[model samples]
Structure formats: C-alpha cells, structure tokens
Target: MQLPAKGTPPPARDASGLATLLRTAGATDTVLAATGGWLLSERRSSPATQDGYIRDVSWWLWWIQARGMDLTDVSFIEADTYAAAMRHAGLAPGTRRRRLSACSSWYAYLQRADAAVRNPFHRMDLPKRASKPSRYLTEAQLDDLVMHAVAHQSARTAAIVAVLKATACRISELTGVQLAALGHAGDHWILTLTAKGGRPHRVVIDDDVTGPLLDAYLAERGSAPGPLFATRTGARLQRSYVQELLQRLASSAGIPDPHTLTPHAIRHSVATALLRAGEPLDVVQALLGHADPRTTQAYLHVDQLERSPAHRAGRRLAAVVARRLHSRTGTREPRPADIAQAT
Candidate 1:
C-alpha cells in the first residue's frame, strides 16, 4: 500500500490527530485499533506525556513514509537504520531512548489490546543514557554565574539561579513553583511542587544567601497571584526562556562552554558540592529527589579533589603520620579564603 501524501498539517492537539498520523502513514488495522481506540481512551498518563507519545510516534511514522516504506512490513535492519539516524542527528541519548520507547510502547499496547504486529524498535539497541552527569559547573563556576546574574537587572532570573543552586530542583519544578506553593516552615522556607512522578515534593529555601536573593526578586515581582518565576510581562516563565537566559548569563560570567550550563547541570553541581562537603550519600539522594539510591551514587564517581570528603578524612591520617615524624601541626583550621560561594 502506498503512504498518504502529506497535506495541510492537521490540528495536532486533538487526539484524533494521532489516528490521522497512523492512517496517513498507512498503518494496518491492528495498529490503528491499539493506538487510536485503546490507548487514547484507556491510557493513564499526564496530558503532557500523552501528547509526547503521539508527537514522538508521529516522527517515526513520518520517517517511515518518507522512505516509501510499509510500516507493518518494516524489517529489523530498517529499525537499526532509523536508530542510527537518530544518533547521527545529534539527539541526546535520553531523547533517542524516549522516542524509541514511545513508539515501542504503541506496539506493546497493540498486543495488550489482543492485536499482534511486529515491533521494529523492540530488538534494536537504543542509545545508552549517561551513567553520570556528562558536564556540570564547579561550585566556583556556580558562584561566578550567580554573581553575573546579581550584576544584571533581571531579579527574576537571579532568583531562579539561586533557587536551583540551593534546592537542586529540576527546571520544571522551578518553573512550576507558584506563589501559593511558597510558605515559611520554621528555620527554612518551603516550596511545594509536584515531583517527577506527580508526587508532592517540597524544596527547602535556606542558607541565607538564596533566601535573600529570592526575597529581593519577590519584592520586585510583588504579591502577584501567579508563578514565583515569571517573565517581565508577568506571564509564567517557560523552559525555553530559562535556557536562553542561561546562554546570556554564561556568556557574561565568562564560563567556558556556556551551552553546557543548564538548570539540570545546576542540580548536578549542587549534588556534587553537597557530597564534597561530607554530606551522606543517602541524604544527597533525598535532596535531589531521586527515588532510587543507586541513581544518586553515580555522583560518587566524580573525581575526588582536595575539597572532597575523602580528602578531608585524609587530614586526620596526615596528622597521625605527622605525629610519627615528631613534627608539630597547626592547632586550628585556617580561615576559608572565600565565603561567597553559597549554594
């Protein structure tokens, strides 16, 4: 069967658009039943996740049709080729994996709906997610970045940076924080946000530094009943805006490889910094909101330095060795050279 010719783009947000995409790609009866009939009506996912599945499946369908191929007759070799193309396009591993999973899920659902069709993506070797943060700012670099934000005039932007540093919250959490979600909780101010799995998560606003920065930002933002982080016109802050803001901040901060700095990287930086400060691995896990302890352990692989907890532990070992040498050591710790680096 020939693929349907591309026409004027259909209205996408509608659920029927997904069925249209499958029909246009020449999907067989069973496939259509699984996606358009069962999944749309039965699947329990957030609206965003549901839309993402449709959107991702649309790309695969388009690619298949572009090759003048039959979707139901796709062979394993063709699946590998598509996976390779995704890599060659420079999509991140997580992105590639998610897209493949999205399409693969449709095939899985087809079987659950008592229909069988070949899952081209099921056997293909998808991209491997990075075991640890591939890139992140050092604590020193974080200070420099925040300093640049302070010098700039955007109070909202500065508070966003400060909160990310202090709480290690995800960008979505940062953007989702409402004025109503923020409240005082004893020594620390608390922010309530929905976590990754639609769970209630509270981020602590502490350390004096971040709290004060947010205070100034909130003063300027006024007691508005909206998102704590918003644009100049008072609309909710979008992720794209935060990304572009960082690009500008990184340039101003003189940070190397400005594009590498992201809100998630700030999360990684704080996790690493906390681990470096002798914070327990499990505590850091809780701070970052990783439900799995092993996920947080990945930060332990970060290269140890003079500032590492292990290095600090070694100071006592060094003192023992010094006593063996009959040499006196300094009685007190030296004053820290920099106290401005708060996160």
Candidate 2:
C-alpha cells in the first residue's frame, strides 16, 4: 500500500475515507469503522479531540503500512517498536503520549469487540513527563498590560483582556460568549460559558475591574445579540486575532517574551493568584470549571512555593539588608572628627 504524501492532510471524517484507508493499510475495515463511529458518537468528545484522534490513527496506519505490516497482525512487539520510532523521531513527550493514547484506545475498542486477540498497548510503558509549573504574569505586569490595552487599544480589546483575567475562561469559551449570556445578579455580573466537552458553567465577573470595561465596550458596540466580543462590523472575533492582540498588548506593555503571552497563560495567572490568596482548592476548581480536582491541584504546587515560609523570610532578609546598607552609607552619625571640624 502506498502512503499519502508527507504533508498531506489526514483522512476526512467520513465512512468512505476511513474504509479506504483501513483497506489500504490491510486493517479490519469493519472493526476500525465501528471504532471510528463510536468515537464520533461519544458525547464527551469535542471536535478537536475527534480530529486529533483521527489524525493520530491515520499516522499509525501509515507507519504500519510502510513497514509492510498489517494492523490486525500487530502485537506487543510492534507496539514497542512504534514507541521506539516515535522517540527516534524526537517527538515531544506530550505529543508522544497523546499519539500512543490514541492507538491504545483503538486497540482497546477492538479488544472489547472481540475483533483483536489482545490490546498491543495494554502493558507498554511510555516515557514519564516532567512536572513543569504553569507560567503566568505577575499582578503588576497584568495591571500594566490591562492599562496599556485600555489606553492604547480599543474598548473591546480592553474588555476582552479584563474578562479573561478575571474569569480565567478558555479562549474558545470567551469567543463563544454571547451578549445575551451576560447578566447581573444583585451586585455581581455573571457570564455563562459553554466550556470544553459542552459543559455549561456560570462565573461571576469582577465588578471593580471587568464590569466597567464591559459596560464601556457594550456602549461602544450598542445593542447586539451575537458574540459578546466582535469587530466594528459585528463579525465574531477569532481566537488567532485575540492571541495576536494579546501579544501586541504584552509587547506594548514591555512584558518579557511577549509572544508567549496567551489566553491560557492569563487563565493560569488567575488560578495562581486565587490560590495564593488562600482560596480553597475546590472553590478554585469550580471557578476554573476544571472537570478534575487534580488538574486544579497543579496551581497549588506553585502557590506552595510562593507562600513558603523560607521565601517570605528571604524577602524580609533582603529588605533588612537593603535598609542596613542605606543607613551605613547615608544615615550613620557624623564621624567625631568631622563633627568637631564642623563645630
């Protein structure tokens, strides 16, 4: 079987394309098609996730076909060899893990259907990932960024930054926000977001900051029922546009590595700030709309370092040292000889 060109897009999400690919790879077309159908039918699977899984599987099939091996004949040895090939290709750890997971899931589905003898990935061990802390802007930096956006950019841009910082919503969720989804309950403003996996959550807006910006933006936008954030022509904003806007704002604000400033980084900044303020993990989890408490716990690790007694003591000691140096250089009592001469 001949593989697609190196840079060709993966097979489309359709029965005919899937069947053709499976047949070309010498895979069980009926079983693989059933698995694909099941994945598409999964209520929790987002479009991105479905597309990713399909791409991963397509790559796996190509790899097997190129080696003159059939997918149905794969074994634990082939799985291990695939892992080695991935490592040899210098794939990032996260990418390797996700790709392996996609293959594993397909094999598991086949096993359950009695179409395969064993799951090739059942006992395979992938490389362990290092725990890296999430990067976020400091409060001062955030303030500066927001101030710059407000002063130099449009009202809508400022409002977008404010909402992201305060609510920690994903960029997709933010773009999906409709004008009608915003409401006021007593002293608080609420935003209803349909997050990943189609989960709907309501979060309060920080009235002191985001509220005024939102009000100003809405006034500029006039009454609209479409996207909460839109262009002058009322077209919905794209995620890439928001990202570029943020990068520009960060650069204008003198933030280091401004290009790395993304909506998720702002979201992480919010979580870190909340955790440092001693907000409970469960509360922060709910606020971030994290499906798992463990995902929220990553922020706690960073908070622990920031709030550690040693870190606080070090800051205090540094301040004391600075004061002592200042006193010795400028505030010490005049030397006796110098004072006598002056007298």
Candidate 3:
C-alpha cells in the first residue's frame, strides 16, 4: 500500500481489495504507519484491545470490497446496514458494539488527517447487551478436568491450569508471571503477581501445587526472571498454545464441546469453589482482583445441591420455633381437666 502525497487528490476509489484503500489512505510514504502509531498511543486500551481494533478495521475494509462499494463513498446508511448484517450473522451484541467502535475510530483518524470527511459511524446506534451470569464448574467437575489435565499434559501445562484454578487469575496475568514473584517462608511458597491495571496480588501455593510448580521450573533450569511457561522452542508460550492444550485434554477426557473449556473457566471455577466453601464475599472479591464487588458477585451463585442442606436446616428450625410459640401462647391444651378441678 502506498500513501498519497500531501495535497494530492485521494486515489480513485476502488471496490475491491482493502489493502489498497488502507494504503491509499496513508498520506505519507507509509500508508498504514500513522494509523498504527495512533492506535499504539491509546492509553485507555490494552495492547490486545488495540490489536482487535486494527483487525476490525481491516475487516471493514474487506466488507466494503465484498459488497462492491467504494470506501470513500461509504455513508451512514451503509454503516447501519453493515451493523445489521453483523447482527444477522449471530454476532453477540457486545462484539458488534466493539467492531463498530473500531470502525468509528478508523474513520475518525482519516478525518483528522484530511484524508476523509465525516465518520459515518459516529451517529450509528450500537446494539444493547443483555446481562448473563458467568458459567463456573462444580468442584467435582473442576477436579476431573484438572486431574485429566495433569495426567495428559506436560508438567508446565498442568501447573498452568492448576494455578489458574487455584489463583483465580486471568490467562494473560498467569502467563506473565515472573520467577522473582515467588517468595518462601519455611515450607510455604507464596506467588505474588502484578494483576491487570497494575494491581498486586498474592496467591498461596498449596502443598499439592508446590511440588508440580517446583518440578516444572527445575526441569527447565528456570532460575531467572523470565517467562515461566515456554514453548518447545524455548520461546514465551502464546495464548493459542494454552487453548489448544485445553481442547486436547478436554477431548481426551470425553468433555463435550472441548472449546468450552477455557482459561477463564478455570478462573470461574476458583470463585465457585470459594463460594461453596462458604467463604465471605469480600474475601472472594479480593482474591478475584475485582475492582467492583458487584463483578465478583456475578460469580457467586450457589448450586442447588450445595444449598439443600441450609434449606433443610432452616425448615427444621422453623418447625421447632412454631412449636415453642404454640406452647408459650397457651395453645397447647391447658387441660380441660385442670379447669374442671379448679371449679
């Protein structure tokens, strides 16, 4: 892609090939360079989020090409139609909203550079998102999944799953753990982590996990401040690797829809386990690194099986209280015989 020179007329619009439009949109020698720079400078979003925006804009370019519409001639109606099409394709509302925002940002950049006029997407309404509770695994199911992961995966992968479940950490946070984060007090090892948004948290390593983590680190001679999980080639492990590992393990364990087994699910399992153990909400919220208690509360649902005992106990207590109240109120037979004897 080649950027047009300053004050030059925009290249004649084309209907196919987004790479061409992206190139022509560049006003300098590097057509895509400016856009990339602007995206990287955004402080509000993470690197991953910025990358998604770039991908979304790239897709919008492809959509323009597939529909035989000139990118320069895109209008508000066209943007609305595209959004509708995305919804028709079964895209989630949140996803559609994000994609629209990405497109809007791209167009806004073009307007700033005088490469384009108005962003058609500025006035477009986004889809409304419905609230859905997070899904977490039961303790038995969590045990089964973790045990299967341990048996089928390498020590590193198994430890990754274990830490994710026990620590309630995001995948990025867990994979980004540093070796120096580990501190020991006698037989106990505590792993400290810098969580998302620069929050620090500490997770106590249970006896069961300590052996696996130490063994995995030792096997690799991991004594420095480097990535704990690495690929076969000794490079930092990528997110896709963890996902594939879960899929393979789930399939082997006869778990339906292996794709459903994700790192986030492991985090959810941690909250579920804590709630089942009758841990207080504040402690769970802190352990999960939730800035808002409400976010953590979403993961605090109790299973019917877990609540049955409490429900039964309440019923029993109510019956006993009712009997006591009846006796105290003289509802119990004040023997008619006692009344007759008194007369």
Candidate 4:
C-alpha cells in the first residue's frame, strides 16, 4: 500500500472506513487490517484513545514502509530496533513507552484472532522511569485551600476539594460519582466510586469536615439522582472545569505555584498523610483501589515522615545510642569545636 505523507493525520474514527483505508493503502495483511478495525470499534475505547492508537500505529506503518518491510514481517529484532530508533530520535521515555505499548496491544489482538504466529513485543523490555517525589500540600496548606474554597468559591468547589482529599480518588472518579451511589452508615457517609477499569469500591467520609462540606453541597444540589457534582445547568462537571476551579481556589488561598495544585496533588496529600500516620501499605492499596501494591507504594514519601512521631522516636534512639557509646568508651564523639581547638 502507498503510505501517507510522514506528517499526515491518523485515520478517522469509523472502523469500517479505517479498515478500507488501510487496505487501499497497500496493507494486504488481513490480520493487520482486522486489528486496525478492532481497535477503532472497541467499546471501552474513547475517541481520544482511538485517535492516539491510530497515530501510534500509523507511525509504525510509516517506519515499516520506510524500511521496505510489511506489517506481518515485523520480528522481535525489528520491534527492538524500532524502540532503539525511537530512543535515538530523542523521543521522551514516556512517549516511547506509549508508542511501544500501542504496538504491543495491536499484536496481542492479532494473536487472539490467530492472525500472527508469535507476538514480537512479548519479550520487549520497557525503559524504567525514574520515580519523582509525589507533590502534595502540607496539612496547613490543605486547610487553607479548603477554607478559601468554602469562603471565596461556591459550595460545589469546596465539596470537590473535600471529596478529593478525603477519598484520595482520581478526578475522573469524583466527576463520575452519582448521587445515588452515596449512602449513609449511621453517623458518617460512604461514597461508592467506580474507579479505573469500572471497579466499584466504597470509601467512608468519616471526618467531620468532609461530611459537613459534602452535606452543604448536596443540599444545594437538591435530591437528585444525577452526578454528585453538577453545574448550575444540572450537567455533570467536566474534568477541565474542576481543574480550573482548583487552580483558582489555590490562588485565592495564597498557595505558591497554584498551577501545580491539582486533584491528584490533593490525593497525594491524603496518601502521604495516611502512610505517615502508620497506616499499612495494604490498607492504602485497598483505599486507593490499586490492583498492585507497588502502585500504592509510590505514594509513600519519606520526607513527609520527618514530622511524624515515629521519625522523632528514631532520632531519640540514635541520640541514646551515641550517649551509651560515649559512656562506655570514656570518649565522646569530637565536635567541630573540639577538632578546631585541637588543631
């Protein structure tokens, strides 16, 4: 098939049209054509996801054409070489990984359909990303944020912040929450969130602050079965709108770098608070609804622990050990003053 120009846009969202376009462009492999169609037609995939997959796959096709190879001719070595080329071309590590993942998904689909003999990406190793410290607000900063939202912004904004910090839920989860999903257990309220992969998990709003704030927001929203957080027009709040609201609140609160104060940052603050309070990793994993414990472990921060009781205890123990050694040896560890005096 004749490949499109190097910078051409990806195929449109119509699955059948996309398949026809691939076939007309000289993609003679039946499996390759079918995989492209399947990707476009997958019910779980959003339009944005479809566009991303198409772009990534289009880049792969262009690469194969440039190298005088066919889609079905890609071997493990070719796949590895493509990754190496991406790296040498100065693509970011995350971008390279995403592109490789898109290719791997296509191959996996082909394998499921018995269109390919083997998956070339089966043995491909992804680059390890350096873990950065999770950005979060101090407890005082968080309190200031909430106070600003409550006083300056609307009740909806305050409730949004409260729910995010209390539940440590993703923004998507918060926006998707339905009023019907919220339930009261005696004195406290519980939120049933459909997290990533449509997995439903329940979290309790046991704190007095969150529960009262949520109650005020709900009272303003009225007894409705729609989204827990909706606009004046009764439409569910969009993710971007929520992000902008948080930024505005952060600015009003006098927080530095207001742009960095996001829903995820609030979630990070909650996770760090829990971990520093001696919450078990497994408990945090369950609360965050992480399928893997390692994912939850990433939210744990050592720096946040500096002000905790356990950290103070550790410092006290070290001091005690030093004093014991001094008494036993009849020689204290020399201070900078003692060294200077001796010199």
Candidate 5:
C-alpha cells in the first residue's frame, strides 16, 4: 500500500485513498523497512520489533483486503462490522485486539502525516473484549522458564525474558533500558522506562532474576552506562529476535504452547500475578503504566469462589424474617430494621 506524501491531497476517500495515505506515510515495504531502521537507531523500537510492526501492518493490509472494505472510507458501522467479523472468524481475542490496534495506530499516523484528515477509529465503538485475561504463566511455570532462560548458554537471551517478565515492561521498554536510565535507591537499583505515549516510569529491580542477570551481563560487557543490552555483534537487539528467542525458551522449558508465547505475555502475566496477589487496582494500573485503571480491571475478577459471610448472613436473615411474618400475620410488611438496613 502507498502512503501519501506531505501536503498531498487526501486520497479518493476510500480504501485506496487510505492505502495512498499509508504509502505517503512511508508504511510501505521499502519505506517502512527504512523507517523501521531509522526508528531502531533512535531507539523508538528495536530492529526486531520494527519488523514485527511491519509484519503486523502487512497482515492488517491483507485483512483489510479480505474484508473488501476501504479503510480510508471506513464508517463506524463498517468498523464495527469488521470487529464482529474478526471475532466470528475465530480469531483469538488478543489477535483481534492487536489487529484493531494496528489499524487504529496506522490511521493516526496517516493523520499526522497529513495523508488523511482524521482517524475514523477515534470515535467509534468496537467489540468488547473477552472480559478476562486469556493467557498467564503460573508461578511455577514462570519460575521454570526463568531458570531455563538464565541457564541457557546465551546470558543475554535469558536476561531478556527475566527483565520483561519481572518488570512488566513492554518489549520496547525492556530493549530501551540503558545504563544511564539506572539509578540507586538508597539500598537498591532501579530501571527507568520511557514507554509509549511518552510517559516515563521506573521499574524497581527488586530481587528479581532479571536484575542480577542484567548486572552480570553489564559487567561482562564492560558495565558501561550506555546501552545495557545489545546483539552479539554489538548492535542493539531487535524485537523479532526477542520474540523468536522467547518462543525457543518456552519450547525448551516444556511449557504449554498457547499458540505463540511472546514478551507481551510477560506484561499480561505480571499484571495478572499482581491482581491475584490482591494488589490494589490502582497499584496494578501504575505498575503497568496504564493511563486508566479500568484497563487493568479487565485483568482481574473478584474471587467468586470465596463466599462472603456477611452477604450470606444478610440473605439468611431476610428469608427467616419473611417466613416469620407469614406465620405471624396474613400479610408481610417492611420491618423497621430491614428498612434501616436497606437505607
């Protein structure tokens, strides 16, 4: 697909028009590859993940075609329909979310590059998520995986997973960690992250496995304060390499294949673990650097298995009072205590 150029007139107000905008924005093969390379140099993305984003955009382009709808002219109804169709196609909830997110981001890029006037995704309703986090590594599973990753011949590969899982960092955030971003906290070290949306936060390097691995790795690599991690060739690591490495680690650890295990699962696993430990919603929200707590709420469900004694007591008392009134009188009336309780 062709992205539009600067000051180019908006495309034909259809899918092709959207494609033109994308082309203009340099989301195309040659341009996107170059753009990804540039973003890598600037540390916007690891070279590997830029490739993933490129792949994601490629699939989105294909998916757009399969649906036979013009993204440039996508209406609210059409967008909604696309979401529904994606669900009906048996796509995993996470996959659907990513595809939608990809489209949403591309559209925004189009707008910024002046390829399009506005992003249709800005104000449209879409499908509700599955109401729960789908995949999370159990504590035991996480431990085993970390152990295996750390023991792997490649210390750098192991550290990648340890850091991503322990810190709940996006792969991008993990890759962006540099020596300059680290600071001492009285008695401990901290990893600073500047995430997407330009928000900055700190990930405490608690007694987590990745922290020590990172320290050792740093020392072996000369312990500089520049890039903390990099490829064996001394170039910064890529996102695709991380994904592939994660999958290899999972396979070796005898972990169940949830289709594709990724660094992203680290984010979900950490958030789920925090919520399960009864961490406050706000705390989890901040740890994940979410702009809203509601987003984190989707990862937690109030434990229904444990019945509250107070709630059961209230129900039992109401039943008893209802039976007593029927035995004492021909009709039932609101008891004063019940009224006060309701109030």
Candidate 6:
C-alpha cells in the first residue's frame, strides 16, 4: 500500500494474473467462440484492450441469449433493437459504438468460416467520435467544478470529478484502481492503474486538489480490495455509470447541453490545462500516457475554440455596426453596453 514516491513507475503486472473478463463456462461448445475466447487467445490486442473487447462481446452475446436468439439468425431489427436498448440503458455514444465494433469483429470471424453468416451490425450507423472532445477546463475551472460537486453532490462524485481532471486517465484505467494501488508520498498522492497492455501506470495528483476528495470518498467506501469506485455491491463502476454521472451533474448545474460534459471531456480538460501552462508537447504526451504525441497535440486546438482571435476580431467589427445602427436611428452614440450586446 505504500509507494516510494509519486510518479514512480508501478511494478509491471503479470499477464496471467488478469481475470478473464468474459466467462465462457456457461457457453455450449458450439457457441464457445461467440463468447470471444478466440479473440482473447489470439493476443491480437493488449490485455487491457482484449479485456474491453471481451467484455463488450460478452454482453452482446448475453443479451442475445437472454432473448433466446442465435447470432447466426439475428436480423437487423434485432441488432437495431440492441443498439436502442444500449441507448436506453444510458451507454455513452462512443461506448456503444465500440461495443458494436467489438461484436462486429466476432461476427466477422464467424463469417470467415462460413460466408452465409450475416453481420446485422455491418451496416448499423453509429455516432462519429469527434477528433478531439469539445470540452476543456483550466485548472481553476476544474477546481470550481470539483467544488460544485462537493457542495451539490456526493463525496464519490467529487472524487470522480477530481480524478478525471487531475490525471486525465482513461475511464478503463480509473476503474482498475484497487485499494492497494492508492498511496500518498510527500506532497503528492499516487494512484496506480492497470494501463493499456496491462502495464502498471502511475499518476501523481496534487494534494491541493484531488487528494482530499479521493480520501473523503474512500473513507465512506470502506477498505474493500475491489475497485476504488464501485457499485453498492462492490463491483467496478461501469463506463456508462461514470458518463451518466457527469452528464447528470452538468445538467443540475445548468451547463448548456449537459451531454457534452462527458468523462472523456474531462480527460481533454487535463491535456488542455497542461499544454496551456507551457508544458512541452512530449511532457504532456507522457503524462497522458499517449503512445503518439499527435494525439496530445490535438488538445492544443481546444484553446482556439475557447478564445478565438477571429471571433474577437469579428466582435470588434460587429461593434462598428452598433455605431452605424445608432447613427441611422438619429440616436446618441452607442454606449459600451450597446457595443457589447452587438458583439
């Protein structure tokens, strides 16, 4: 439970130590492949990624089985119904799209063996993921949002907000934080996570912001070895739950289009905050655990949207129009308020 210092690389995780995310025990031999065993066994992806792929494919299979349907004969209507069902269940648009993709890959494998197997999801429409998430926050604004959660929400909500903003970790990484992975050393708090490829990644958070919020939540959550953020039954919090939590809080706080304040948006906020503070692009990429700096480079555009020089120049031009309008009306020169309103 005690780490030497913050930002220290965590011990590497053993591949065999990872639990199979999807159980194939209940599946009949004929349908075993449908549970995503081949995908997991093939090692085409990192263990963390395969975990996700299996979890998603398993859920799709489970839903179909519950409905007493077989994948071989599933129609587009049934696939469409499943997509609708995921939406109704509050799955984020991106999460739903990935889940569908994972399932489609499984079905694709099935087709290799027999060309007659139809992929209902092959033609399904999914929401496009934005090149970069639209939302970003300065450190101060992020703290204010955390304060809002503290005042208007639960300790757990505040902690969730703090973790996302401070670390910029992926949702999967956050869910992997166990009781043993949390520690404090010197002035910073250390959080160890199972990163992509099952590597143990560490994020160092300042005590000034995230430390107290996380501590408060854990005090209430108890000393269980399960996920740091868990359901009442002590299972890891699903990605959908975290997304819905942020959306709900944003709605209550009267943020315009609450759905835009997504969990991934919080990740964007961290990358933006770091870059604007004059952190090097490589440093930002390293902190965010991005394999490619180009991914981190995308965060730089967020400021243009927030403080567009073109927008400001256009506002100045619009103020000239206010003067024209006032001259036409034979009224006194436009006041500062009038110019502001025109802009």
Residue-by-residue lDDT tens digits, candidate 4, 1-343: 2334334565533455546545644665767556756565643244445656776766676666577765665699888888888777667787778878878888777777766666778758987674666568877888888888888878888888888877889887888788899997787678998866556788999567888998888888899679889888778888788888888888878998998777888888888778878899999888898889988887765555565899788566666666665766666764544433433
How far off is model 3, as Cα RMSD? 11.6
Q: Would you list the rank order by TM-score, best first? A: 2, 1, 4, 3, 6, 5
| 3 against 6, candidate with superior lDDT | 6
Clash number for every model?
0, 0, 0, 2, 13, 0
lDDT of 3 by residue, 35-147 (tens): 55556554424544554566567666756766776565578988888887777767779877987987887777767766555788997889887676555677777677778
Model 2: how far residue 341 lies from native, Å:
30
lDDT of 2 by residue, 1-343 (tens): 2334434676645445656777887667568766766576654366545666777777787778778876766888888888778777667788778778888888787777777777788868977785665568877788898889889988889999999988889998888788989987788789998877766789998868889999999998988679899887888898899999999899988999998888888988888888888899899999899989999988766657767899888666655655565565754434434433332
Error of 5 at 104 (Å): 7.6
C-alpha lDDT score of every prediction, in listed order: 0.74, 0.78, 0.68, 0.75, 0.65, 0.71
TM-score of each model, in listed order: 0.71, 0.76, 0.64, 0.69, 0.56, 0.63
lDDT of 3 at 187: 76
lDDT by residue for model 6 (207-263), tens? 786888888998999997888898899998888888898888777765667777777
Which sequence of candidate numbers ranks them by lDDT, best first? 2, 4, 1, 6, 3, 5
- Give the winner by lDDT: 2
Candidate 6, after superposition: displacement of residue 259 in Å?
A: 2.7
Q: After superposition, how far is residue 14 of candidate 1 from its true place, in Å?
A: 7.7
Error of 5 at 130 (Å): 6.3
Off by over 4 Å in 3: 1-21, 26-38, 41-45, 64-74, 88-94, 105-117, 130-134, 148-153, 176-212, 221-226, 250-259, 302-343
Comparing 3 with 5 on TM-score, the higher-scoring candidate is 3
Task: Give me candidate 3's TM-score against the actual structure.
Answer: 0.64
Position 262, candidate 2: lDDT: 86
